[model samples]
Target: MDLLRRRAEAVPRGVATAAPIFADRADNAELHDVEGRRFVDFAGGIAVLNVGHRHPRVIAAVADQMARFTHTAFQVVAYEPYVALAERLNGLAPFSGPAKTIFLTTGAEAVENAVKVARAATGRSAVIAFTGGFHGRTAMTSALTGKVYPYKAAFGPMPPEIYHVPFPAPALGVTVEDSLRALAFLFAADVPANRVAAIIIEPVQGEGGFHVAPFALLRELRALCDRHGILLIADEVQSGFARTGRMFGIEHSGVEPDLVTVAKSLAGGFPLSGLIGRAEIMDRVEPGGLGGTYGGSPIACAAALAVLDVIEEEGLIARADAIGERLSARIADYAASNAMAPIANLRGLGAMVGFDILDAAREAPDGLRARQVCARALNEGLILLNCGVQGETIRILVPLTASDAIIDEGLDMLAAALAE
Candidate 1:
């Protein structure tokens, strides 16, 4: 209550909080509020805590780096951790041939830099994104994002030359064919293929919903980019780092992205984002063209290296699959139950699961009920979140390191919330 009061006075209203509780501490998959109440964390800090809150390995890495040095501003005095981390990411790049990675401070920077790289490589100024896809919060990314209400509302005069086509979501009445046709139309109508720099997409839409991109759509996009000399960028900011069962979500479709924007869980909980691209395209930018003063902090790089180690050593990729199965099964049972509110459209890849709350008639999405479920889940000591075009999706992002018992406990709370 005191913290809420202080926050009301100090913080801007534009920054909304999903829950009013203040975090006192957090463990692998649980958080304790300042009031000393415990809650199961199913949100995973908006897909940024796949390794969970304060993993010992990440903490130790950060502490060790702190003991050595915090920041030298990689641009001023290139550090080893940054280079080593970039090397690891490059080796893990989803595409074939030599790859290169440049670290940045946030997902937006990685995405924005990716556009810059694409334009530099292709000598084109226009970019294409999909409806229901979210790239970032920056001006350029906001223009790239398809959603309107909150992300773009009142933020008038978005940057030009960013086009959006329909994303294939059957529930939304947009089919793969519809999306492809729209793309073709976009090429002919708004911008020509030759003038387009790149087409950026999330292999699995995050803020739009946990809808997995159809492999057919990806294949078509790849072919289109190939024929037109446009780059294909995979924005893995929310779907990367083992949250999608694979190391990178785009790997699921066997469609290699020319450039991948990665953030969120890249450094466990640290603020570290990176853009990995084919070596030739990456080198298109001159020496002084890329980099930020705090682009690759030594502490974040150390944490990211440790995060990579944790993902490999802990078998988190496989763990993500198991967690997804458990969540899907439970949600499937909920859909069958008349005791719960109408729920439909359970979808996701790996553990990045989402289901929509629907009207009692099952004819339409029920954003109100979805919000109520989240509210009830919070009251029941479970931290949950909603997404999708209509805000009717309940996305489950519990940590991969979470124990089965913790996962089940969170699900039980979720069930109770749905019943209410």
Candidate 2:
């Protein structure tokens, strides 16, 4: 703790703060703090380690690649792993038709490149995004993000021609029709539909309280985009890779996006992300228009390939559904017994579960209490995270690799925190 406070905590206020558990080592679904305390990691590095921390396969693959080569700058001297990884992602994307993929180092990079591809393909400038959507923190993604605090605060003068409309949140009383109406209004009032290059959304919003975009709305967006030549981009940075019981979150709805941005859990713990889309759309960008020095580092690619193998061999998609049901049931049970601050608006798909924190005094949504619950859970040996625009919602993002015992243990800590 002292080392962290001195070295890390003092570094930057811009860095997000969490409980003072300095992870010394991690394995499977458990993390050992620097103080040697064991904690069940429900947070999963904010949903980055879906295969769990330091899985032997990922570790071994990364190690093997490191021994052969680390960075050759795929553009300068191409590598087989990069090509192989792209091939795998191209097939894994939600589209049954032919797709292409471009790798990058972070979720933000994937989002930025996706927009670039959209603009290049459509030859348009305006991009439509939904309220409570979180794409990334790049200049363009920050513009795409709807929530103002933290993600957008102090990051002034965002990109131009990006527009935001209300996304449906039934729990908050915003219906799918309301959201579509707002989009129509946006086209009339701001950027017209033809002028819009892309309409991006998170199928199940991550920072925006895990609200699943209705299938009806997604179908509507696809129709609208098709009518106006606007591309649909799914920002699956936080919800992709079996987190939602499918390879991609957009799979929840049968609607296909023109381009999809994926990251977080793509490479287990490695820094890797990608923009996947129709082959023609992806080919619009010039050879040098996309890619970075470490865009598809060989080691990261190897690790990502290993992650895919793990997901398939372990049948994590099925596990995600079962875990989500169990977690949702437990949360519902807790809410039923505790009438003082009943959990309202329980929502999510697969293992990505979330519920509201009602006010202790008035039984209304309480953001502070949710933060308190997270803090208490951390102290009681469970890693947790809070989301939602108002931060009044607690989300459970435990790894699909987690065992039933670990899930139960984490839920026990949550129940104890609520009881307190």
Candidate 3:
């Protein structure tokens, strides 16, 4: 309590915190608070730990690299680990022909760089994003984001030439046709399709809500970009790294993008991100055009390598499927119950599940109810997160490494919160 009070005095309100408890230590799917309360972790550090907390492989890899050496600025004094990691991502990225990578330190940096790369390659200044899409917090990405309150409120004036179209969500009353038409309108009204550099989207939006974009929309957008020579940039920052039951979220669509911005769970908790794209497009920028000093920390590179090994060895991609099944089952049960009735929208891909909490008759969203459920879940020893433009959706991004027993226990706690 004293620490929280101290935090209130020390930290600004703009730096938000979801839970009141202060973390002391954490394991795979569990977190211990400063007061010795244990909470089942369903947040996964906001999708930054798909492999779980402190995996032995990730720990050992970071330790090994730290013992050897840390930062040498890859551009200044090149290192093999940096090159090795980029080579691995290059090979894994879903782009058709040859692909290349440039590392950054955060998802925002990666998003900004992806746009920069697209503009440089296409010689166009305009970019298109979607409603309810979340790219990053930087000035450029802020303009790309569709949400106004909270993230964008009081932060403008944002960078120019960024237009937003609707992201398809039938539950939200925005359909694929609506989004496509909006894109067409954007081209006609806002910017010429020929001058639009890129269209960035999340396969499953994270902060805006866990709304999955239909595969048909991806295919349509791909053909549209082909017609206009615009680049399609997938923002896989929160949905990447096997969180959506695939190596990359965009894989679910099977549509190749010109550029992809990735981060979040990339380095198991270490700060690392990348802008990966087609080789020719990526090479458009000359040497010294893109390089951040702390972009790809040697330690982070080592940890990322270990993360890949752990994902392959543990079969986390399949694990994500199993986890999603269990969570969906539990959510279905909760919705069917008389008390938790009319909870509209049970949707997501893989384990990235989220459902809206709606008022009686299921007509109006109930953000207050969502907040109550989260507070009760925290009190009952589970960490839950609420998202959506209206803050009425509860999204689960649990670690894929969590055991079935832990997942069930967390779900049970969540149900109890709903029951309360």
Instruction: Indicate which candidate wins on lDDT.
Output: 1
What TM-score number comes out for model 2?
0.98
Tens digits of per-residue lDDT for model 3 on 14-82? 888899999999998999999999999999999999999999999999999999999999888988888
Query: Using Cα atoms with residue i matched to residue i, what is each candidate's TM-score against the true structure?
Result: 0.99, 0.98, 0.98
* Pairs with backbone N, CA or C atoms under 3 Å apart (clashes), candidate 3: none
The per-residue C-alpha lDDT of model 2 at residue 102 equals: 88
Best by TM-score: 1
Q: How many clashing pairs does model 1 include?
A: 0
lDDT of 2 by residue, 145-232 (tens): 9988877789778889989889898777899989988888887887777789999999999999999999999999999989999999
Candidate 1: clashing pairs of residues = none
Q: Residue 217 CA error for candidate 3 (Å)?
A: 0.6
Candidate 1 worst ten-residue window by lDDT: 70-79
In model 3, which regions exceed 4 Å deviation?
none
Please give the TM-score that candidate 1 achieves against the real structure: 0.99
Q: What's the candidate order when arranged by decreasing lDDT?
A: 1, 3, 2
Q: lDDT per residue, candidate 1, 1-420, as tens digits?
A: 788899999999989999989999999999999899999999999999999999999999999999999988888888899989989999999999999999999999999999999999999999999999998889999999989978899888999899999999877888999999999898888888999999999999999988889999999999999999999999999999999999999999999999999999999889999999999999999988999988988999999999999999999999999999999999999999999989889999999999999988998998888999999999999999999888999999999999999999999999999993
What RMSD, rounded to one decimal, does every model reach?
0.7, 1.2, 1.0
**Candidate 2 lDDT (Cα, whole model)?**
0.90
